[model samples]
Target: MKRLVAILVIILILIVLGLLSIWRLSQDMDVYVSRIDTIQQSVEQKSPDLSLIAQTRQDWENEMQLLTLFLYHSALDEMAEKWLEVELFCREGNYSAAHNTLSLLRQDWEQLYFQELPIPQNIL
Candidate 1:
């Protein structure tokens, strides 16, 4: 019947949209991961660029405004805390601690990134 067809169409559209969002978010996450990698490299060099730290955090905050629409806040909570620690360590010239925090943050980011992929483990 017409009602049944319409419902099926709507469901199909929702599924397609969900797939698109996952693909787009995964791409954005890759950018975020690379951004952190650059910061870690800079910190490893003993430069401790507070400006870069501030800029990256600012960029992340700006992006989160849109990202929040699709992501659960709980998933981001730990990374948010780690980011603050990274900023503090950089400001205090504690590159070693910053490096460690970045590693932890990287793991958190990877967990989020992989969770969205269309892998067997994630799908099954």
Candidate 2:
């Protein structure tokens, strides 16, 4: 009887551990998915504005701040490339490019997400 009780306890512990592992994995996956959705929404809302590019360029020129320039340049380049691709896709009537661009943009977001990984300051 004691042996059977011990086995049941062991099984319960294993099940709990398995559940905990699954929960953690699901949580991480949720974060990645949420970030992807946010990026895609942002991309979809983009308007092909040369003014944005010009403004960013002017900011870089006036400040001589390498970090600002680097970030704005990189984002501008990506946005422009994606915008052009989207225009071409629209001309060709291919809606798939819009979706594909979202995937590509998600990859960019993923890279940034991993680089500046957020940590919860306080656990509620």
Candidate 3:
């Protein structure tokens, strides 16, 4: 009876902790996604700036350290590839290609962000 109550209490605590973890991860990923959106907007301008593209890539590389802990490696790998494509397009003065790649990168970020949610469908 006391043992059963204790077990239930512990289980409740674990569930709360899990939910909190998901919330925190979602917030962090949201920030990254927002930043990507800002970069995307910048890239879509008439004359996209190469310097801004380089800076955004560097920012993403820095974030990868903490992001890798919560996100899947495959997602990260694909994001890295997209970043490379964006950089290449920017260097080649192909603003349209760079914008398209940035759009794909943003989509990936959004997908990863939602993947952190503790959805019942995901579990069952």
Candidate 4:
């Protein structure tokens, strides 16, 4: 009887662990799905403001020239800055502008970034 109880306890613990893992995964997936939905809605409902993002990109590119190469490694900050600009563009009734900002940011990241490229990891 003791052995059976021990086995049952172990099984219960495993079941609990499995349930927790699945719950966590579901929560993460929900966030990811919500964020995707937001992006899709923004794209479909609003237009992109290419001009604004382009201007911001140009300004950043020029500013990058003034900074030393050593600090260039801080791509995370740049990525965040560009992301915020894109979000702001989207908020200002220019989905196209946000898309443009994201495009330029992606280009900059591809060309000048080497560290783990930050791709807005927010789930929502």
Q: Give the alpha-carbon lDDT of every model.
A: 0.75, 0.47, 0.69, 0.53
Using alpha carbons, what is the TM-score of model 3?
A: 0.61
On the 0 to 100 scale, the lDDT of residue 3 in model 3 is: 100
lDDT per residue, candidate 4, 1-124, as tens digits?
9999999999898766654443443344444334434554555667544454455445455444533232335663675577567757676766776666656665655544233322223522
User: Model 3 over residues 1-124: C-alpha lDDT tens digits?
Assistant: 9999999999898777665555555556656676667767777775666676677677667666555554445776778778879889877878898888888888787776556334343432
TM-score-better candidate, 1 vs 4: 1
The Cα RMSD of model 2 versus the native structure comes to 16.4
lDDT tens digits, residue span 9-124, model 1: 99898777666656666667767888888999999998867787777777666655555655455656666777878999988899999999999888877877776445333432
Least accurate 10 contiguous residues by lDDT in model 1: 115-124
Two-way TM-score contest, 2 vs 4, winner: 4
Which structure is stronger by lDDT: 2 or 4?
4
Which pairs, if any, clash in model 2? none
Give each model a TM-score. Answer: 0.70, 0.33, 0.61, 0.35
Steric clash pairs (candidate 1): none
- Between candidates 1 and 2, the TM-score winner: 1
Ranking by TM-score: 1, 3, 4, 2
TM-score of 4: 0.35
Q: Candidate 3, which ten residues in sequence have the lowest lDDT sum?
A: 115-124
